[model samples]
Target: MSLGMACALASACCFGIASVLQAVAARAVEAGSASGVDPVLLLRVLRQWRYAAGLALDALGFLLQVTALRSLPLYAVGASLAASLAVTAVVASWLLEARLSTAEWAAVATMCAGLAMIVPASGAQGQHPGPAALRWSLLGLALVVLLIGALAGRFADRPRALLLGLGAGAGLGVVEVAIRLVESLTSSWRGV
Candidate 1:
């Protein structure tokens, strides 16, 4: 495998492992009295070793992701990132002693298969950098995501969580596209 693909997979692994650690830490902590999204609870969770480790891994994963993006097409990189769910399931089963249903196992297998198929098909990235309009759109999307997040606090727990998840997913997409738009890592500020 190429170094870029390897980096993508490693990034996925880091993210997957980080997710489990964060979940464990989040679950272990007691709920705070804050009515809305509790910033204080985040500070509290930061004290947990698992959570801290998870954050560190997330940072590493992001850096590795950028490295992967330098060589791999965005589609391949996105697939690799999605494949992190497989890692998460396996790690969760092992570390948390959680049993996976047959369906879940099958899903994980499918994700792996999809990623395997994508790797060979994902040739080199195209030469075209994203247009100025696309960058503007990303900025617009960012604002929309921020707005959604702001309004999400009004919903009950389940709906709020769902809204936040959607917003975060959109935000991630913006970042992914923005990374592709940037021509140079050194001039990242101007790129974004």
Candidate 2:
């Protein structure tokens, strides 16, 4: 694979792990609350320091994602981001001092397999898209993914989040593939 593709795949792996961490962190915050407490209320309950720390972690994740995008294709970046689930799992295990159950591992495995299928398998077509098209397409796909994820939020839980996040990730992967294909076709026609 080319450096760009490798970066994208690495980013996807990082993203998967990060997602898992976020899940673990979220559950911790939820579990820390008193009985019958609404999760929405958890933020208010968190002291300023706690909130800041959480926000910092989120910022860190964003930074890593952006960095990865610089070296990878859009689809690669998206797939890596979907990988946030794997990240969440690892972080949860370490922070909570627990191991993922067999069922949870199985679910994560399935998600990773799906991600592999979505990411581009070839590196020969290392075409770069124009800034405008890349921006608009990514924005559109992101909006759609978030919209779908939000719609799924009503059914919030680890499993639901994992599935929804993967759905969003797949959307991103498809966009990248489309972009690469278009770039190849346009470039070929120009050559002709």
Candidate 3:
């Protein structure tokens, strides 16, 4: 449990810092040169040191997240990941030199409070092998998300952010489910 908690926290911190770095790099790019969803923007961002660092952090975060997911319940892992927003808020204030209003600080506190409540209630990952139907459903969902993201490529920045954010959230959710599914499969294989 302690290791899981550590991994989760590490994941959150890495993701938070990465987000701020990536955002800063993206913002530095000139506007009106390319669509928000353009691959060229990614190429441009990659030229920035901040973006490259952010990508490295993202890779580290993903490993930590997987470690956490293996040991903790999906709910616990999910909540911790969601709490990355609070980490982002802090990182933005410190590294990005952004001011946090009183209300924003309170919101971060609220998020921490909520996480405190969740961690205690969370248990070990369940042993049950979820239904095959669920796996198929998740696959379908992934395909649908890819389609939506492709379509969103034509959209402007504001709408593109919303769509991409939603897609990313969904992708993370799918990762949680996939972890559970893998656990179930491993358990079943061991039983055999």
* TM-score of candidate 1 on Cα atoms, chains taken together: 0.90
Best model per lDDT: 1
Q: Which ten residues in a row have the lowest lDDT in candidate 3?
A: 30-39
> Candidate 1, residues 43-134: lDDT per residue as tens digits?
88999999999999999999999889888988889889998899999999998999999999999999989988887888988878778888
Error of 1 at 100 (Å): 0.5
User: Per-residue lDDT for 1-192 in model 3, tens only?
Assistant: 478877998899899999999999988986544434455777788899999999999999998988888888887888888888999999999988999999999999999999888777887666677799999998999898888788776788789889988887788788778876775456679998
lDDT of 2 by residue, 51-152 (tens): 445555566655555555555555556665666667567566776676899998887788778767755562333445566776677677767777777777
Assess candidate 3 and give its lDDT.
Answer: 0.85
Candidate with better TM-score, 1 vs 2: 1
Candidate 2's C-alpha runs over 4 A off are: 1-50, 97-99, 106-125, 131-192
lDDT of every model, 2 decimals: 0.90, 0.59, 0.85
Off by over 4 Å in 1: 34-39, 186-192
Clashes of each: 0, 21, 0
